[model samples]
Target: MKFSQSIFLPIAAIALTLSSASFADNNQRRIDIDSKVVTEHKAKINNQRFSYTVATGTQPVWDDKGDAIATLQYTYYTRDKVDDRAKRPLLISFNGGPGSASVWMHLAYTGPRVLKIDDEGYPIQPYGVKDNPYSVLDIADIVYVNPVNTGYSRVVEDKDGKLLSKAEQKEQFFGVKADIKYLAEWLNTFVNRNERWRSPKFLIGESYGTTRVSGLAHELQNSQWMYINGVVLVSPTDIGIKRDGPIKAANRLPYFAATAWYHKALNANLQAKDLDELLPEVEQFTINELIPALAKGGFIADDEKRRIIKKMAQYAGLSETFVEQNNLDIPTQFFWKELLRDRGQMVGRLDSRYLGIDKRDAGESPDYWAELTSWLHSFTPAINHYLREELNYKTDIKYNLFGNVHPWDRSGNNTGENLRLAMAQNPYLKVMIQSGYYDGATNYFDAKYTLWQLDPSGKMQDRLSFKGYRSGHMMYLRHADLESSNTDLREFIKAALPKEGQAAKY
Candidate 1:
């Protein structure tokens, strides 16, 4: 889970209601839910020079009574002097945390600007922004939206200049269903306002944002009557897939093997084989052998259990005794701690490549997330400076890297099935998943499993694709994957666009 900002709002004002007093001028209190600031800029992306206009602003989120209840902050980038605006592709991007800002993707992934991190993604000195050489801006117009209470986004006072009741806040914007519901409506208004109704539309989200976009796929089609061309899920969650008991236990092996291989902790023969070669063998064992053995549990024969234990130890780089003691269900934390215990360090949860030192090596999990702290160190200053200096969107509001969105309702998460239903209904719709091989939280193989479960009948298999990377959760942070992932995205967008005069039929 992401950390919350220390500042807490009153229960009645939990919607992150902005005070009208903040915008006061000449002692006249006012509010502007639909204000904006525009700036012109130029960048060379993919070796192509282009002038672009960035509109950084807030758009109103209206309530059922035709009143604005909240304002979502968004930054949109459009190539200037485009001859045919209707034909351009518009990519809507978001990052996860349920409470996270859209900063990750905005400054580190697909946007024209990226952090000044090292080639391998560690924070560098004099942290700042640089032109992204691999941005997809040449092929698509992009918008990064911050949900309520994230970045500069905030819920607003009601018609009477009073904060909404707690019930209204929860019912409006704080749960799985509610989050998707409002965001779909918000997109509808955004498209209408920007006259993007005729453009080829795509949604790209990472982590919990995967659930957001997945549910939005169905919600937009069913509720808002808006159809999208493609959906990209990066380092995706299960998206509400049911992976209980044996299935869950078996799924962790491939990730363990990948992380182990990266750290060179595997046995000599397994280490000798390339990761590409070793993973298939482990995956085959996981699906064909491990899942079944785990399903048998205590009922399994002694010899079969011992054999499974040995294979698991070899692949996982753990002692067979420990595997046996855990009864074949090894916790991921234990794996992270135990993997490099001899070296007096622990692996990161999000990216195993990053190492951390613990106070004592006696814990099941590391003292902290080695990757997240490093990310915040680099991302915080970069985004804060970029918004004010480059974009010229001035505001005194503190940008919450991770806002207060707890008591977040996780119920009714049927987004995976929802995406399936959306695909079934919209013949023009296609899906692509991007995963990092070293992402332990939402491992790569489980993403493939989500793909498999999404279309069990394999009817839309042709429209589905999966791409894996060598880095962790935010794979694009690495220089090589940055170039390759953007290329994959460009290809996917072009492939998903319907041919001229083509029918939306199977």
Candidate 2:
């Protein structure tokens, strides 16, 4: 689902020992239903097919006496052959937006395979296609969950035939706490039915999904809290950052600047040096130098801090005076223009994967996320086609890979550090953060910056690993980067999984 303006929105596959498989032909273009209410999806792609299901369950909205009111749908994907004895790693994946679906991650990064983008790295194909050997399905079973009201998932209505409206959905499902509670119950049942209770469970969330995982980790710990092996957070958000506070707006500045330097069309000295080093300095400069300049709240000291502003402006690849004019508090929009204006272009705010040459200064909130969208549109259909024809599944509704995520719950009021508190309570729950160096939406540096600010008091650095890739947020879209990320994920999974012989004994 799209988060900001047009910029946002943000899979797992089962394993197949075989390199290639045949599509189901006539049987392929379909979905399998466990019941009238629950439907499963299976796709065959790249001649190396995988499968998944969209199963539905209900969560009680009140005390035990009442009928269950919420219908929750989660997408489950696993290896073709799951070893009963092997405590296979299970990752419950979710996207951001609070209102987002699991499609982006499912189709792009964590799924068994990926859709190919064009050379400019936008989602277009000569209709070109490729295999994602780096797909994590080899090591872990991935579940891309579309929280109710997203993707094909939705709410449970009264037998009286009540349909859910946008307002009703928000009233029922938009909040994080209730969503996680329902998900925990739903997952518990799904696991029991599938007999996957022995698996080592993990959660991988991007952007706001990261927020969901954090809280759910604790909710699972305290409420339905079970044994969770680990969590992989991509581009996380701190409640403290999202909430109204002295830090919310402050934390975003560095992120904008960090992304600005990487948007080559913007940075005048794009060829200057390795951006990896320069970005952190920009982050540090924003926090250590520029933030205080803004916080000073006085004309005289503010003037003196021009030196700091000069540094920030310089590091951001923007004019020093621009920083002065905005008093080092430039909003994210300005960065897009200031960095690229010289080239008669404006970088994007969404994925930061595109460049838009804008001649006018003002317009509606511009979503330059086409860099990401264009890449997936061309190939997602092919992948979906393969899933049905080659893999064993059936469906009536057409699989919606990705689309407009509107009326989202951007008013994030999820406070109560229970998520972090639970994480601290369960020292066993580890986290791995994978970030794209160039992603502007949830900048990698911002991810780290917010993490440090949260101060996970448990000294859990070993449990939390952050890896940087050369591409944008969906690093897997790039063949080379996905391979490396796959290797890293495999290692991570290996560490979390039960050792070979320890299966039943554990």
Best candidate (score: TM-score): 1
User: Could you tell me which 10 consecutive residues in candidate 1 have the lowest summed lDDT?
Assistant: 1-10
User: Where does model 1 exceed 4 Å of error?
Assistant: 1-32
Give the per-residue lDDT of model 1 (tens digit) for 7-56: 22222222223434434442533334676677777778888887887888
TM-score list, all predictions? 0.94, 0.78
Candidate 2 per-residue C-alpha lDDT over 170-269 given as tens digits, one digit per residue, 9 for 90 to 100: 5556666556666676666666766767678888887778877876777776777476777777766664444233244455665565556566423456
Every candidate's lDDT:
0.88, 0.58
**lDDT, candidate 1, residue 343?**
94
Residue-pair clashes per candidate: 0, 29
Root-mean-square deviation of every model: 5.7, 8.8
